[model samples]
Target: MADITAPELKQRLQAGETPTIIDVRETWENEESRIDGSQNIPLGSLPDKLDELEELKDQEIIVHCKSGGRSASAKAFLTQQGFTNVRNLLGGMQGYQQS
Candidate 1:
């Protein structure tokens, strides 16, 4: 899976290149703070949510969580599941907020 830094993502967003942003964070954590327009599918629920993401398999998908750990796992899972374009947000939301 490709790794994207939070600043690069922010620049892309600012440039109006809106790739699908998937927040694999838990519901409570999502409520605390999240990037606007991101889809919240908790990490544990991702397997069941494959249908929801089917159309996005060929699109650029940027996965993120509280930190980078969960996002890395999510990226690995997506790759194993045959997702063609997946990326992990380095440092996750913490990095995004910092940027």
Candidate 2:
């Protein structure tokens, strides 16, 4: 899936589309600022949480972090684990805040 820009994500949220968004930053980072409704699942804990997310394997899942690096890794990892539609949030939280 193509990565989603912060503006696009904001638009979707405004339109009342409940996209499945995953914040891959650490708990403290997520607590600092976050897109409302996005799930906080730090990248390091993803493997252990796979079972909880199994139902969403074929669904669209957006992942983001403080910057873009960790979420990019999260996207790659999820895709490798049989997730068919995984997207990274471009520029991550920084971009989202800027937008």
Highest TM-score model number: 2
Overlapping backbone residue pairs in candidate 2 total: 0
Once fitted onto the true fold, the runs of candidate 2 whose alpha carbons sit more than 4 angstroms away are none
lDDT, residue 41, model 2: 96
Give lDDT per model, in order: 0.91, 0.96
State the weakest 10-residue window (summed lDDT) of model 2. Answer: 28-37
Model 2: per-residue Cα lDDT over 1-99, one tens digit each: 899999999999999999999999999999899999999999999999999999999999999998899999999999999999999999999999999
In terms of lDDT, the best-performing candidate is 2
Give the Cα error of residue 49 in candidate 2, in Å.
Answer: 0.3
Error of 1 at 64 (Å): 0.1
What are the root-mean-square deviations of the candidates from the true structure over C-alphas? 0.9, 0.5
**Residue by residue across 48-82, what tens digits does model 1's lDDT show?**
99988888888899999989999898999988888
